[model samples]
Target: MSLTQEQKDAFKAIFIETVTNFAQQVGQATEKVFLQILPLTVVAGTEYLKSYEEDLKTKLEDCKTKSQKIIGALSTVKEPEKVEKTGDKHLPLGELLGKRVQRGEDWKWDDQDGGIGSFGKVVGVKGNGWVKVQWESSRNENRYRWGVDKAYDVKVVEIVDDLGDIPPLEEQIKKPTSWVIGKSVVRGRDWKWKDQDGGEGQIGEVIDVCDEGWVEVKWKNGTVCQYRWGGENAFDLKVVPKPKE
Candidate 1:
């Protein structure tokens, strides 16, 4: 977005005011001691003026930088439709689609087949609080619903801004397999660190197996994550016999 003429004028006035006030203050200070230190004062005042000019230049540059940042932020402001409030929900399509999100606080992590801390991208909107999400660990798109109350609703999907150490989308969309739930698996000896779900050589139970080649594993350490198996030569895991109690 381009700045309005009024805004440009306002900024120019501010810069002029700042420079004029600073010059006036410096002139007044120098005037008070002008006669007392005439000879040597000229050289010292020249050096001091040079330093002051440099400092003022830096401050002006900083102000310009801050102004540009403000303009950039204003340019990114969502349109009316993007912030349209639907009851308690304030997010619009501009904020949700293509955004990274995590399961909400009220998600049924334990009761459901999925694990906690899963992340996904909002790929489509079905309106009325429903959205299609392409989960980070699977290629299939799942439907997620938003709650009426965004602050304390069970259906809220938390937006994730920083991805941190999450695996890339390229590695997450592995081909599907025919693995069954309840099967036990361990990291194969040939498994590399790059194929990690819950660390190398860790034993885990198959909590859920989707047709999209995504196998959700609950590790001995209680951490759960999805991994690739079966198709596309994804041989990172080896099925192991369940240990008897």
Candidate 2:
């Protein structure tokens, strides 16, 4: 006779409970035997007890294996039911919208070449998990779709009060002929000095400017190097105006 759904469920539950209880009782019995043998410590008593314990442990492991097999068998006894959705229903995009993000919030792209450390700002978040961000290094705005299109590629790192106060990359890299020795400057994104590894946003002072336009900069860390002052490397160095003392 075929059993009803409720009857089948009750039978399966009872079977699992019974087997689990039996396994627990066997485990407890094994532990009791080990405890009872703990007191004997004569010459050969130790060796004998150790051998018996090993044998007992092997039996317990076999029991555990059998219990696991019983549980595995239960899976074949019943098939899982699948629920079908009828309407044009969709899961809500929660926590992916403005909740965790806001305008002018700094972010870093989680990509190769250490984009994770590169700073950017959120321009806006479109409804369906799309967020527009303006990168600090490139100064370019790009749209990223969260969850679906690796929106997690970029993570919000900081929030600024005013983005407008930040100067453009072009203006920051402009070479001023009036720059004199001992003037402070910052390493721009285009700055790629070998051996020194001068990272982006590193502040330094101009130690000397050669006739060929190669400027020797003394970084805040005391490391000095002569970096090229023209082409791609030219924009790599930015002149920083000294703050009022």
Candidate 3:
């Protein structure tokens, strides 16, 4: 469903205000200072701005994940009707029919599966076994009728069901845990690192402060895991709580 006008307005207000604040903070004066220091930062250290970009993205994704989880939990009572799979849940008519011809629940796309070269996103569910999808007629596929049949292969695309509730402000805050031995965040960001929930490689202290990504984490098992910054593919960032709702 499209966002309600009020919701849209609220999002607009928050987004615009936050952007304005960021712009003011990073205004011309700040940019000049950054430019002057850029050479020194580059030579003496890795550009922090680049890493900070990732830091922002990580925090945003984490917020989204938390939102999804909370939405899922509160959804039972607040959004039972939302359980219906509209977009990605329902495959397109052609894709659906093609799947019927040949079957694949766990189907995967590889060098083989004829990609949805023509198939667009699934828009709505038509009647039984039929789904409406956005698609342009394929020249080689004999018009849109090429509706992926037994001929074409399948691939799954991820689509969210709907925009969940933004969540109460309190849920956005970070809670501390003392079960783990080591508590280390990214060099600059604030995601605490832990080992497998608890125990083993759980305790660590800063043996020495190194540059950028490297931090020494001692597991409870007394084993040291060395990281080269982006080593784990996932970097943690500090959590900033939104204003109380």
Candidate 4:
């Protein structure tokens, strides 16, 4: 199921919060370790406890990796400007979103050669020139990353999106294209639920729980559903279409 914007935003927010908290906790834990009085001892003691610590570190690394993935997935637009420009000053998001996005193309106009440079497929494109074309970075890899090089300036040219790498706007967002609902209730931070059908259910994890009567959920099965949060838990039946494979 495609995720709703509310659900997506909530999820992104949680992941960001978790990553931030983990970093802080790790810093504090490291500081504590340094403050230890192991002046003349080995690096560790209680082999079992040492093993546990190792496992904890491994888990922490895994969480960090997952968090990184979340960041990479969610950060697609540039940070929002105070106001969207109506004219040629800048393109409103509606003009850019769902626009023809190619997978292996590039455009390099305003060049030293004084010509338009559009090449390959889009790979990815933001507004008119802001894009990530099918070009490889100095460091080549078979993986996608949240390119932070979109905020840069090049000589003889106006600007560049951090070397053709950019993240989504921290403010402006794409509307959700899909969702779900049914005779079950989801609640709490985890947004878990007990389906009245005598089955365990969850809206997935809580996306943004808005002050409004809406709670978004992106379920484990990759379904995004939102419910008006009020009254009784179970409401009319709502079904969601399976996402295209």
What is candidate 1's lDDT per residue for 1-245, written digit by digit as tens?
A: 99999999999897556656755777755444444445655888899999999999999999999999999986775333333445423465324544556666545434231356666665555445555566666545666555323321123355433322323333432423322344556775345545355566666766554445556667887877776665345655666656655
Question: In order, what lDDT does every prediction score?
Answer: 0.55, 0.51, 0.36, 0.36
Regions more than 4 Å wrong, model 4: 1-79, 82-89, 97-116, 119-245
- Which sequence of candidate numbers ranks them by lDDT, best first? 1, 2, 3, 4
Residue 129 of model 3, lDDT score: 31
lDDT by residue (tens digit), candidate 2, 147-231: 4332244544333332224355575445332132344567655665643635656677655444445666777677977766664
Root-mean-square deviation of candidate 1? 17.6
TM-score of each: 0.27, 0.26, 0.16, 0.20
Q: Where is model 2 more than 4 Å wrong at Cα? A: 1-169, 172-177, 194-200, 231-233, 243-245
Give the alpha carbon lDDT tens digit for every residue of 52-72 in model 3.
888999999999999999989
Native-vs-model 2 lDDT?
0.51
Tens digits of per-residue lDDT for model 4 on 106-179? Answer: 22333322223322211222332343322222211111111223321111112222212322322111212111
RMSD of each: 17.6, 23.4, 27.3, 24.4
Measured by TM-score, how close is model 1 to the native structure? 0.27
**Order of candidates by TM-score, top first?**
1, 2, 4, 3
Local error of candidate 2 at 195, Å? 7.6
3 or 4, greater by lDDT? 3
